[model samples]
Target: MVRWVRALVVGAALAGMITLAGVVLGRIYADPLLVRLVAGAAIGSVGLSVGMRRLPNWTVAPLSATVLGAYTIVGLKLAAGQADVTGPLSQIARDSLVNGIPRLLTAMIPVQPAPDTVVVPVIAAWLAGLAAAEVAVRARRVLLGLLPVVALYAGALYVVGPNASAAGWTTPAFAGLAIVALATSARPAHAEVPEVSAKLRGRAMAGAAAGLVAVIALGAAVGPWVGGQVSASPVDPRRYVQPPQVDSLDESPLNRISGWALSPEQRLFEVSPTGAKSRTVRLRLAVLPDYDGITWRVGATYRNAGRVLPQLPRLPDATTADVRQEIVIDGLTGRLLPVVPTPTEITGARIAFDAATGTLIRPEQLSTGLRYSVVSEVQTPDVNLLPAADVPSGNAVARFLAVGPGVPERIQRLADQLADGNGAAFDRATAIEEFLAEHYRKVADAPSGHAYPNLDFFLFGPRAQGGQVGTSEQFAASFALLARLTGLPSRVVVGFDAPAGGGAVTAGNAIAWPEVLFNDLGWVAFDPMPKSKNPRPVEEDFTPKPTKPPTPPSEPPTSADTSSSSAPPAALAAATDGGPGAAVIAGGASGSVVLLLAGLALALVVMRRGLSRRRLTVGTPDERIGGAWAELRDALRLSGRPLPAHLAATEAAAYAKEPSAVRIRRAAPASEAAPLPPLDELVAGINTVGFAPGAADDAQADRAGSQAVAYATALRARRSWWRRVWWSLHPGPLRWRRPL
Candidate 1:
């Protein structure tokens, strides 16, 4: 009973380690909490339970691991809406199982829960948990349990690489080590312990205290160096590049409101419009026109010469207000430089501009404390005089109005549901914008478990879907996607914002909104995220309504020409863009984790096999009797008697008086009842061979060894599942390694 409790306590500790690792790794990849917790708990409980056992250790470990791998693969496929059982699961096995251990060790930490992401963590956590249980419960080596827990953290660090905070995850692992110590200190026997005499045990307590401190100090000193040397990012970028990195941005649609609520009170950057602006102004970073059903991004990118931007593609009849804005970047993050819409010129030496997308970029990554000025003609169209595209035409129309597959028909139906089938572009856009304001609720962080592409969830999901609630990105993505379905050339724009009343901007100032293109008006912006009360009208910077606007800059590019110009780079024109661009590095000490587990598994097999063969197969005649006797005790355990501490082996023996008795039994299935052999005969032989060596009968000793092995094998075959579990936790050999 005490031993069983100790085993359970150790199992609990291992489960905690797995849970902690799962949560941390999941967060880095933006996996939903529910998903991580459920998966972690289910896998950890089973894995750790099996690990703490001593019976069937060889086959059990391998069998459990295979099941874990299969479960993860199948479950993920089901959740992803792929085929139920065979096709998708088989493909996953084919892709990942060939190099099973290798691929698992090499898998990347994807933000979304992809197949590799799900399988690798479950398999790794189970393996680690099993080791922790075995070390703590079976070996009764408390300190050794830390090995597997540490290895677990190390594997996570390698996979997560530099994506999240490393220091934050180590605290729980250290706690698990403490639990290991407590579990290991408990004796496995059921009997009560003799009271300790204080005087005699005085130095024992002190010595243990000192030893613990010394071990902790040693771990702390070594941990940093070892941890720093490991990495999980994919080493082969050319072969398997992570998507392009999105710095400090969680681009999920549900993040909309939190971004708005971003340290609004804390100024991240300062902006001063050269000319007093009419209202709050937004500093455009990049105009993303391509929607891959999930997110929006710039389709085409180009590097402009430092500071100088090419003239805005000549709009025919639109009024432009040149506003010079000086910006002092404080604490904000992103690679693209910020400028007000319609930038005519930028004053900086090391900046590059993408003329087609109107994006100002630094050759490398963005930095803090950046100060720059921009010359921009912020455009606002005359509502009455705005270009009328009853039937819009231009080369860029198809590209601007493009819709990716999987867009639900409900989105298109919503447009028709709200307005007449046809209306002027401006009127239709305004109606869509108003409809969004009226129906959707603006939520900063949506609950976990929202489906992927999340479009369906945003539009029609439950309450949390009592109303559509999401961040600006979702609103913009949905509105733009929906707007495009209605024949309005629409796209989503993401950038830094400078409101009229505020002098400084913060993370909350990072914003996204929808934009529509008119042949004569170029691209126009609008707001779709719902407001708390009376929603503010979308801002448009216009020189007071003008008559007969300036005309004839040039005819808008044709659809064919626009597609040719604004298309994404040929090298990266996939359905999904901006993933870690070769960022997951899978080499180094981190990459060697799989090799470690593999080596450990192999070494265990060889050790167990060699030990068994020596004890049961071959040895000197007398040695065989000792070996045979040892085998009989374990055989009883496998037979399910297990000889609980209160039961005496001598009293329980069916025959303790005879040395020449033969007690071999044939092999049978594990579920049936198998009789225990004549242990008295085996013990008598052991006494003769071990104490009165010269008097030993060689034939009797060999026969006992052979019969002992055969009976143990039969007992093993007839062992029940629970019996196997019981001995697996406290197998006799586990205690053979006396304390150093």
Candidate 2:
């Protein structure tokens, strides 16, 4: 009865620890389903571990596996609504397994609790609970058992990364429960100790309690000081993980602006207000931020997403209206999904979303009759704050300030002339927009292209030289690049101006515009279209008489003369800013190679971890015993020391090795970590399992597997930190048939 009570406390503590660790996922994924899934997995694992404590070790592992699979299937079915689970079970399972971890890192947050996104967290919590309970309760190695729980908590922290800061109470709560579990666990019955007098025992207990109190008080005083010294931004793991690539992203939407203009009357799509009606809606299809002289492409990293898309931080002084619209595709093509600016929620279709760019894409092509619903938060900035608003600085927005090489010197001069005397970034942005609208002409059939040459001709080429007339494509691109050259941090957007009050959107409504990024206001739209008063409405076709281009005095408009004694050198520096020159591009290419190698290295680690998991968890009793020894051999090879293949199993312990400095807790030194529980016993078990058929049982197999992992961990820990890291990441053992 006493043992049963003790087991209950330990099991509850383990389950609670896993559950507390799982709260980190709640921040990453907003859905309440995560709560149910995590709690269910934690409780179920603990119950199974306690129930199976009396069973043979091999039988217990297989039973646990069976239960875990069933739990996952049920949890997934619940995540996908009952009506939505009409698809084949195999498809659901495949998607869950394939997208489980990959999408979690790349998906925008707060991620919806889709089956794929929830699977990883649920499984991790379950496994952690089961392992920790089994070790603490059955094996009676309380400290050793805490390792799995610690790993789960660390993983949760790592996966959440910089997305969310954990609550203040979480760490302290977990630590407190862990201490309780340790205090409550029953000691081994085989332990023998001399009896101590009551007085001495009380004194010893008092001294230990006083020491713990002193440690806690000291930590309370020093913790805040140490925390203040650390960096504000946490290390984000998403940087190392490559985002999903789609072939359709290669097709630039900016290139299609002119083509759409030629067929202006063709219906592209239609939008109907599902909620509050609005006077106008701007459905953004793509945001083109990257330009390499030839073309502007969408540089967003789109990841698989669910109904609730990630939203930007709301500005305190900004007024926002939620406009919900139901959109139906009529003649739209390609994979780009059009949504109103600053979409907060989406439904009616599966999509990949890029939060940074406020863009969405259907992995599959958009077909006629396809429909989706979107809820957008249209921001109304306080005009009072516009004049004083600043632009973001540092490496975060540096890409927006970068200009491709070979910008015409006249364009820079013109930008300077237009934006002269404007102290604020917003004022300069409006000045440029006002000048372009008043000075440029809009033509119905302007040719496509927004390259450096094209923009130069539009801004400075003589009228007779095919200059001064182009489509919205040229106007928007010119504005964006020119803004970059003036250090305003801008990007071009390719979208449609749907009819006022929401109706059919025709190709005629296809428009391009520039948006300037302000520190507090986000991306504020600017209209540089000819004859345009605001971002809405593409103007009707207009013809203009040819005008002579203005000629610069003394210099004859040379491209090399980007500087002048007139305006701020900052503007000229931006125009001539060799941001990412040839050498930088070369270094970027080199970095790509290094990333590819690192990805391959990570793949090897995953493959090896999977192999190790299967060897211990799958197969018959005899096969498991043999697998344990094979694991040890691989560990030996990875640790930079391998016994000869020809060496007999009995000779394993006798292998020569020098002592090392590192040690794993109270275990043997690095040299002695190779042999545990007597090498002779391990050798005899392996021989019996391999040759003496039917001689090994589940209990013996389980023992060998456990011993192997402990041995491997200790052996690896003995090396220097760098060598240990390399040992974990190295892939040489996978290709080698035998260790030397």
> Please, what is the whole-model Cα lDDT of each candidate in the order they appear?
0.57, 0.75
Model 2 compared with the native: what TM-score? 0.62
Q: What does candidate 2's lDDT look like per residue over 1-740, in tens digits?
A: 88788888888888888888878667777667886788888899988988788887677777888899999999888877721333677787788899788877877777777777788888888888888888988887878999999998888888888888755788889899899889888465554345756667789899999999999999999989878745566678888878766464445798888888999999999998544455666789999887777778788898877787777778778998887888999998988888888888887777788878878887678899988888888888887787878777556776786667766666655554444345457777887887678767777687788888888777766666567778899999988986775558888899988765668999989899999888778888888877742322112212223457677768564554445566467656655685655656788999999999989888988988887888777888777877778777766555433433434566554542323112232443556455433344457667786578788888888888887777777767765555677777766555545321
Off by over 4 Å in 2: 82-87, 188-234, 245-251, 274-279, 301-305, 315-318, 382-398, 416-435, 438-440, 460-466, 517-522, 532-740
lDDT of 1 by residue, 1-740 (tens): 76676666666666666566666556455346325633564455445454537675576666666666656565556433321112455675555445334333333223334443355566666677666766666676767776876677666655555646554645656575466657557556555345645654677789999999999999999989777765434333223432233333423322433454545565667888455445777777667776666556565444323233556665656566787877777765555667777676665424445556676655345567777777887666665655354434445466776667655645544554433422345776887787777666765564322222476667665553333566676777777876766557787777766765547877677677888876566677788767555433221111123346467699876756644746566524432454543323444455589788667667665665566678756767667676776666554433322222112334425422121111122243433443545566566676576467867667877777776766665555443444444433333453342110
Cα RMSDs, all models: 38.5, 29.1
Backbone atom clashes (below 3 Å) for every candidate: 29, 0
Residue 57 displacement in candidate 2 (angstroms):
2.3
- The candidate that wins on TM-score is 2
lDDT accuracy of residue 730 in candidate 1? 36
All candidates' TM-scores?
Answer: 0.37, 0.62
Worst 10 residues of 1 by lDDT: 655-664
